[model samples]
Target: MRTRTEENPDYCAIESAMEVLGGRWKLAILKQLTPGTLRFGELGRALPAITPRMLTRQLRELETDGLVTRTVYREVPPRVEYTLTDAAHRLDAIMSQLDTWGRWYRDTVRPGDAERVT
Candidate 1:
């Protein structure tokens, strides 16, 4: 249920970003992986709502995009872990900005006349 959108060549940057992180689950995936390497089961437990199949698919895409590194260990039970690569650290600054914007939105834009947390 996806469609290509190169129709507006001028929006290459927007499209490119979307191509990388465009999905309901991608950001949550990145956030969970940001802390450190984790086993598949650990990731699954941390993100209770995400199905194992979907997490596997996202991990594969992130590995292909050079954002995540996957390692497998040879053992009886078998072990697999995923860690964020240096390239993904670039998101730190962007995430900080997003945090600021979120605070601003909650303080100024959100309605219902709720009291500010600050």
Candidate 2:
């Protein structure tokens, strides 16, 4: 099925980015990989809330999008690691701004609601 972006030819650059990073798990996965390369198991542990299947799928999609790279080593027990690409690294500033905005929004807009659980 064609997504909203696929159907609309007038999407701006931000919309294109959102199409790539809109999913629940993509941003979290990217954040986890921002530090350094991590094995599949390490990623799973870092994000215990994500299922193995979902993690694998999100990683594959990120890799395909040129935001992440996957490397495999040949050994007695094969090793695989994932890391963010330069393109993804370039997003650090934007992500930081987003983080700042989140904090500001929480403090200014939802000051007392911070402790409230969804």
Candidate 3:
């Protein structure tokens, strides 16, 4: 994969979006946060397949990309929460459409495969 910089660019918009939204877990994390803010533990439970380290890395990337905002409250033990930025909310419709298309493909194109994967 090529690294993108502000000074030089040569990728399409979709590629740029994928750069931030790439990987299996980013989208799932975003979907979990779509309803509202969630704690680290909650997110971990929601995405049981993701390791804690990988989840932290993805959250950091999302924060760097301006897709997510991480808020840490000053407390005794320490509390941190994540919420979507305006940019991520903008993807709601697109993600919904993709979900619909994915279901259609799984149901019609590969009926047997979906059950095995899930």
Candidate 4:
């Protein structure tokens, strides 16, 4: 994966941030991680659309971003859990704001408003 700086010399902070968490499953993974740590199987069940290989790939990206931590236990069969790092917890506040804004938009906007667009 290319570093954002290498990808864009004049990149703004929000663009850099989006590069980290803007994938199809990234934000959904973050939402699931907020409740607590979860095993690979649990995450798989929570997001039925994602395959095992894809989940592993996305988790690795999140780990690389410093937004998530993966722990392994040396049990009979290796037990592992994924949890959000401190950096990711900061997203909670932002997500909450987005939720509020979404509700407001849904309440105030009509579906036919798109007719005005040309």
**Pick by TM-score: which candidate is best?**
3
* Ranking 3 against 4 by lDDT, winner: 3
Residue range 26-65, candidate 2, lDDT tens digits: 8888888888999999999999999999999999988978
Per lDDT, the best of the predicted structures is 3
Per-model tally of clashing residue pairs: 0, 0, 0, 0
In model 1, the Cα lDDT at residue 78 comes to: 97
Cα lDDT tens digits, model 3, 91-113, are 89988888898887766776556
C-alpha root-mean-square deviation, each candidate: 3.9, 4.3, 4.2, 3.5
lDDT of 4 by residue, 26-94 (tens): 888888999899998999999999999999999999998899999999998889999999999999988
Q: What is the lDDT of residue 116 in candidate 2?
A: 57
Q: After superposition, how far is residue 66 of candidate 1 from its true place, in Å?
A: 0.9
Q: Model 2 scores what on Cα lDDT? A: 0.85
lDDT of 3: 0.87
lDDT of 1 at 18: 71
Q: What is the TM-score of each candidate against the true structure?
A: 0.74, 0.78, 0.83, 0.79
Query: After TM-score superposition, what is the CA distance of residue 10 in candidate 2 from its true location, in Å?
Result: 5.6
Backbone clash total, candidate 2: 0
Segments of candidate 1 deviating more than 4 angstroms = 1-11, 99-118
The 10-residue segment with the lowest total lDDT in model 4? 2-11
- lDDT for each residue of candidate 1 in 9-85, tens digit (9 for 90 to 100): 67466775677677767767777888799999999999999999999998887787778899999997999999988
Give model 1's clash tally: 0
Sorted on TM-score, best first, the list reads 3, 4, 2, 1
Please say which candidate is ahead in TM-score: 2 or 4. Answer: 4
